[model samples]
Target: MEIINFGKGYPANVLLPHTLMQKACESHLQEEKKLFLHYGHKQGEEKFRELLASFLQQNYKTAIEKEDLLITCGASQGLDLICQHFTKPGDTIFIEEPSYFLVFKIFTDRGLNLVPINTGKNGLDLAELESKLKAHNPVFFYTIPTFQNPGGTTLQEEQRQKLVALSEKHDFLIVADEVYHLLDYSMRSPFPFCHYSKRVLSLGSFSKILAPGLRLGWIHCCSTLLNKMLEDSVLGSGGGFNRFISGQVYSFIKLGFQQQHLKLLIGSYRLRSGALYYFLTTILPDVICSPPEGGYFLWVELPKGINAQQLLERAKKHGVTFHPGYKFSTQKKLNNFIRLSFSFYDCDILEEGIRRLAKCF
Candidate 1:
């Protein structure tokens, strides 16, 4: 039997827009061959940045200046760039407890101190965050506010405003990883964090909505921050990262292909999410999980005395797989939790995976 895997947060291979991307590439070569083929600005091609700024402003209802955006390889690179420019080896960086597992390496590789704040159904605990902020004087607070990875929680607007206030009071930067914000299925998300605070550095990626191979993402911040980041030797040496790919993506957006693609992705994931949710809730009534309003994951908390790592080993025998929650925690305290992704499989495969998972429990 084929392994029904739910371990990685990735778009289904079938969902990738191969034809659309090909068309965009062809269009870029035909329309702007010279501009795309030649070395572009280290900050990004001016036209593409303008297009991106307009796209975000239109979609999120926030005014964005082209000068305030920096095109990075992807959100991962954006995070790395931020750490490189803004942090020292031993600086304190706060993050949500049970945060994105991969990013933990990014922080640790930089030799930065990782402080995790407890998260709940409503998102990060403000009291805990404020207390940590007051005591630590952290370099920055990193968050995946909307449809958070491994937690499936969206921070409320009120909490967002309050968090911004806290950032201002404590004078710490807010690094908002918002790649999942645009993938919402039903509930509307709040404006990007940059809108509420000038100190906020918002990171976005096309990996979820489009294809990950494109390797295109942007950093939204004040012009001051953008200028400082652009001064980094990496951008100066490379003359901007992913300029040609950025040009292709700009063509894709200019022709309105991204919006159409987003609708298809949202609709497909919504169905997959519902099917998995129903199966888990009905078959394993004792399992605690919330249906995510958007994004790719469902965070499940198993009953006490269950260790997710051991559970994964058993589930593997049944041809099912999922992400054990311990990987997502800085303190490694959530052994009873697991993260499930609905974006990697169709509804039929997802339901079967959950059915197999239920048996393991």
Candidate 2:
């Protein structure tokens, strides 16, 4: 039997716009091939940054200056760069109890200590956050605040401001992974955390909105913090990271294809996520899960007395797979939970996966 993969969060192959990207690359080559081939400014290509700032400002509904943005190969590289510049080995950093599972590896590779902050249905546990802050000073609180991976929950605006204020008072930076900001079905993405304070660094990637192979992303921080990144030896020696990819992305956004393609992604994902959620609620009424509003995942809590790992073992026999929630937890405690991704398959396959998962119960 062909296994239905509900655990993978990658966009479906049909969803990738190869033709659109080809057009962008061809346009860039026709206009200015030699400039992109040569070394770029350490910060990035100047006109590219300007275009991106305008694109973000229009979408974010807040002012974003080119000076505040630094281009990167991708969000993962951006995080590594920030950790290298701002954190030392053995320094403490806070993360959500259940976060983007892969993020732990980046911090662990850098030798930073990880602390888990409880995340709830609403968002981060603020009281728990303050209590921990009293005991240990963290170099940064790295969080995926909007449409958090594996959780699909967003931090409210009030809490966002409070968190920034705490960061200001404690003199710690807020590293926000906001790569999913643009895929909002609601169309009104929360104003980014960087808007609240200079101490906040927000990461955005074209991987989620466009194609992942481009490996193009940007970091938004105040000019002061941006300079620290600009001075990093990697960029100083290598010039801009992914200069050629940045040029192609610049053309993509300039041609208005980015906006149009983004709309297509949002509409398709909305239907896919809704179908998965509907099938689950209708077929398996006992399971508990939140309705997905945006992003790639729907976090489900199995009925009491059912362990997700055991369910997965049986689910494999039925040719369906999902990520057991323990993988996302810092403390290894959410054994009864599972994370399902609606972005990788269409509604029919999603419905079938739910049915196969039901048989495991």
Candidate 3:
């Protein structure tokens, strides 16, 4: 039997826009081969940044300028750059109780102290966050405000405004990792945090929307912070971040392929998500999951007394797989929860995966 994979947060291979990417490469090579191939400005390619700024302005409905944007390799590198420039060893950083697990290593490698703030279906608990802020002068609060990883929760707009207010009051930075913002299927999300506060540094990537292989993303922030990040030796010494990839991606975005591709991608995920949710709900009635409005993952709460790790092992034996929730936690809480990604498979595969997972239970 084929292993039914609901474990990895990757786009389905079938959905990758191979033709659009080839066209982008051909167009760039034909028009600006020498310029794109040559060394670019340390800050980024001016044309790419300008085009990206316009793209973001039109889609996100926020005022953005070329000076306020800096291209990075992707969201991972963007987080690393933030840590390298803005934090010190042992500095306090606040993160969602269960966030993107991969990011934990990034923080720990920097020797930063991570404090977990509890989150629910509505997103982070503002009261708990405010209490934590009162006690620690954290360098930044890292969050995936929309369709949060692991939890698959969206932070409400009131909470967002309040969080921004608290950030200003406490003089802390907000590192909003918004890689999944554009993938919403039902409702349009609120304006990004950058629009509300200068203290916010919003991260965006083509990885989720277009393809991760491109390795292109951008940081939106006030000019002051952008200037400081640009001065980092990592960027300055390297000349720029992914200049060639950025130029080609800019061509793709310029031709409006991204918007067209996004509709198809979102529709595919919507079907997969619906199928998975229905199957899990029917097969494991006690399991609790809030169907996500947008993004790749669905967060499930296991029945009482069930351990997700053991479930994972059993499911693996059954030729199925998913992420155990404890991996996403800083304090190793939430052992009864699991994160499942519907982004990597079709409806039939999702159904089979859930069936195998049900057998494990």
Q: Using lDDT as the measure, which candidate wins?
A: 2
TM-score for all predictions? Answer: 0.98, 0.98, 0.97
lDDT score of residue 135 within candidate 2: 88
Candidate 3 accuracy as TM-score? 0.97
Which 10 successive residues of model 3 have the least lDDT summed? 31-40
- For candidate 3, lDDT tens digit of each residue in 120-195? 7767999999988768999999999988887888887888999999988899999999998888877668887788
The residue ranges of model 3 lying beyond 4 angstroms of the native Cα positions read none
What TM-score does model 2 achieve against the real structure?
0.98
lDDT for each residue of candidate 2 in 126-189, tens digit (9 for 90 to 100):
8899999998899999999888898899888889999988998888899999999888886655
Q: Which regions of candidate 2 are displaced past 4 Å? A: 33-35
lDDT, each prediction: 0.89, 0.90, 0.88
Question: Residue 88 of candidate 3: its Cα lDDT?
Answer: 93
